[model samples]
Target chain A: MIGEMILRNVFHRPVRTAISVIAVGVEVMLVILVVGLTSGLLHETAKRVEGVGADLMLQPPSASVFMAFSGAPMPIKIREKLEEMKYVRAVAPVLLQFNASGGLDIVYGIEQETFKAVSGGFVFHEGGELSAPNDILVDDWYAKAKQVKVGQTLRMLDNDFHVAGIVEHGKGARLFVPIQTLQELSGARDKASVFFIKLTRPEHTAAVADELRKVFPRYEIRPLKDFLSLMTSSNLPGLETFINSMIALAVSIGFLVIFLSMYTIIIERTREIGVLKSLGASKGFIVRALLSETAVICGIGIVLGIGMTFGMRAVLTRVFPTLTILVTVDWVLRATLIAVVGGLVGASYPAWLASRKDPIEALSYE
Target chain B: MQNAATILAPAIEGFLPGEWDVDLILKTDNLWKVYRSGKLEVSALRGVNFEVLPGEFVAVMGPSGCGKSSLLYVIGGLAQATRGHVLVDGNDMMALSDAARTKLRRHKVGFVFQRFNLLPTLDAYGNIAIAQHIHGNGFDPHRFEVVTSMLKLTDRLHHKPSELSGGEQQRVAIARAIINEPKILLADEPTGNLDTKNSEIVLGMLRQLNRDLGQTIVMITHNPEAAAYAGRVVHMRDGVIVDGVPED
Candidate 1:
């Protein structure tokens, strides 16, 4: 019966079936997009934090914010004190200053070789590392925007530096410069600000951050994970509220759409349902058949939506090198569950209405 | 008439006489159905007393709105009669819950509708096969051959309802109705949708089902020609059974 309901009746009416498919598809797309974008944003921001490769952020006792806001910068002495701690694995210091060509941006500076381990791909796109004290390694996006390439000279801080290598980082905006070069050029007050520390283990991160904060009572110390959330939330307004509202809106709208579409289908198939009822089909049979159709359409929509997400991710990352969309298993599970619930919830009204129809009246219905 | 009634009454009540044809197959006594449309009480069946024995062929003839169909419905356990009792195969329909009525409908009664109401999605074979599947019984290949051939549906078994003629679809509907070998066959205007030629063909198959398989058939139709095919004809008007006549 499932096979017959799924393949024969569902596939027979290509138009209705297509409409069902589209309904399911839209539901799936909405769920996947919501989960994908939110999760992707979270992942991408976290990746950026990890790109700084910091276990904990140690800042100026009074002036430093634990989270890296757009303008606030830690002083150099804080880094010196943090490095002096025995638990600190290694300390890589960075100075950040803003540059705005179109929107807000950040220019980061760190020691050439240590910056390699700290910033990872923040220097050269390929093989070579950040070597010259006066040379800069910017993100590929910024390089293209500024049209600065290797051997080309760019000016900042009232000084010029060779474009060393276009690099990539998980956090912050686009620029990477040598620590000595940025200090001389940007004249950033007390240039050395951030200390990116690779922690000994998971248990040591909070302890180390707490110990660092105690020593620098004026500054806030935070684990990189917490710092990343702070950075992302500060950039977006009412982050939790916005996400909750969007999710609530999607779910409500999804239920309404699914309900109406499925209801219309049931109304259209009233005669067919009557025929089934008259044919000794139990109510359970009809219910199962309707649910089976809903499940199939929902499944189709989920697959299509997920596929679209991956496809869009490919295009997005290609077009905007800075936009990294990450899809995780949790996102897939969440999207699929939403699709199913939407389908089932959507199917509820129609199934009940169909079942409530009197077999004789439905048969007589033209 | 006496001979037909004698033959049919036994089939209607089987060998047992005292239990009101409960196990005999389809039975109803003092069944009253009142249709209330916002305080307008229209009595469709006023204490309809009726019975059809196993393998008996009966026809109901009546004018429009006479409630012949309602009688069939109440007996088939489709509609709940407002008062009195309905029993099929010795089971009290009114006393039993809705679920039990449905079970009786599934296992004991097979219905053929006026519209030749075959499920459009299923082909002729599928329509017949679905009954067997629903009953949790294996599809008998020999039974399939027998019924389809009897209905002259062998050539059309694979065709969908749209592809079949009205008569052919009705025949498939009949095939579906009897595919379960139900105790009682209730057909509502089985020939109403067919042309004369097709009507006769449907009537012919039904007659054969009655004669050979002893399948009890209660058909509701206004056509005199259709009524003539039945071994017994019951005339209905305003929900009352006016006459129970056995046709020779």
Candidate 2:
């Protein structure tokens, strides 16, 4: 009977109920989208890096694993010394330049033969790779997103480069240029940003990585296979704080919305509460009714928020094809739990007030 | 003083000493309810003594500010007396805690209000059933139907209060009040918000419940015509009963 009364009361004020539900939904959606976008970007970037088929990455001392943040600081001559190591098949000394022309992208500068040996080589859809100083190979996703053609002239980094080919994506970057051109353009002549080392056998990865780590103890020598697992918000500086701040913002929105909604509803229903008390409703019963009403609203809001999140993911990916949004079950459940707890906590004070209201006074409330 | 209730308490002149250990269902001894505002104290019930036998239908009549409603509230356990005792069916209402008073209201006392205070969100049936549920017991479908049938509200059971006529809403309130079969039903101007025609219908239902179900009732009213329906009338002036003897 109390359940029925609660549901009926919730439905009694449609506009108020909808406003509360949508507020909570927006809160959940915000938290979910923030977490999803960050996790998706990190996971996608890590997967792309692993797709290079490198057994190890050798960077300059104290260089970050985030390729875009690392600069072309290592000497290109170090590739030969790395190539001299046991079980090392090839070492691709690549220059990385951050480009913000039409969009954000990492421009990879590579020597064709060694890069091909390290990555199994690009699977071309049209044209050919790295045949000229200004020939640029574009991946399919970037090609489609930017509408680049095989014979088109593409300008990046204030330099005009003819499109050499459009290849399959998932090779660490969307655009590739000759190593010497990027090194000269960036004024870091004969210096590579990082080294991608191919091994003769897959099992030799640990042994070679251990050997490299000991030789250059200060350098960031990382096995490519283990890189993705280490790429998380906790492993990245400031990322965890960014996510926590977003969650706090969402929780605050939920709390304030539920608080105002429940407070107003209780005041509006003061006489109704008095009627319930006159009917012998206990304080616990009134408290339970108010909190249950909040829980129901939050539950509906959570489902709506999850649906809205998926809809947004689709719209975002469609608008920006390069963008990836991964909606994980873990985060969805966490957001739902957070919204429920926030709503219940927000309603607690109003529930207590309702319970403590004098029945005669409440009955006489206008 | 003819009986122990009077002999044991000859202080109450109105009682004239009732018979024996008191077959009375309700008794208030020197009840006093004072409303204090800052440095002033205005008394609503001043040394009022009252008694009601089981199955009695009594109407309390008074002018405005005569403390009729306040007396009903105190006797119904909705409020506490300033300094006195209210015993309902041998249980001391003034001595019970807030929770115990609430429990008493749930199981022993039921109330009908002037405004027909049914929850607008619930239907007539829901309003009536909720009381039984609040009594912390299982629902009795037979009693529910019987109460509705007694009030001629069977057809209007599914209607919300807004959809029901004024008389129908009052009938629903009465059904809810007696749905749990409480020991006493306190009606505070139950028809004060109704039209003359609706008032007659609601008053008729109350009399029928009192006569047919033998339900003990204490009703507060100002209209002499409304009080005429009760078996006995107790008139009050300035918070004290001016006429205690039954003139019916």
Q: What TM-score applies to chain A of candidate 2? A: 0.97
Model 1, residue pairs in steric clash: A48-A170, A48-A171, A61-A218, A61-A219, A62-A218, B11-B53, B12-B53, B22-B90, B23-B90, B55-B216
Residue-level lDDT of model 1, residues A65-107, one tens digit each, is: 3223434565666657666786776677788666554444667
Q: Candidate 2, residues A327-363: lDDT per residue as tens digits? A: 9999999999999999999999999999999888999
What lDDT tens digits, residue by residue, belong to model 1 across residues B1-248? Answer: 22212222223221222344333566677889999999799999987777666778889999999998888888887788899887676667786566666667878889998888777888899988887777657678888898988888999988999999999899999999988888889999988878899999899999999999999999999999999999988988888888884333
Q: CA lDDT of A163 in candidate 2?
A: 97
RMSD of 2: 4.2
Provide all candidates' interface root-mean-square deviations. Answer: 1.6, 0.8
Q: List candidate 2 stretches off by more than 4 Å.
A: B1-22, B38-40, B245-248
Model 1, C-alpha of A134: deviation from truth (Å): 12
Among the numbered candidates, top TM-score falls to 2
True contacts kept of 1: 0.44
All candidates: DockQ: 0.49, 0.70
List the lowest-lDDT window of 10 residues for candidate 2 chain B: B11-20
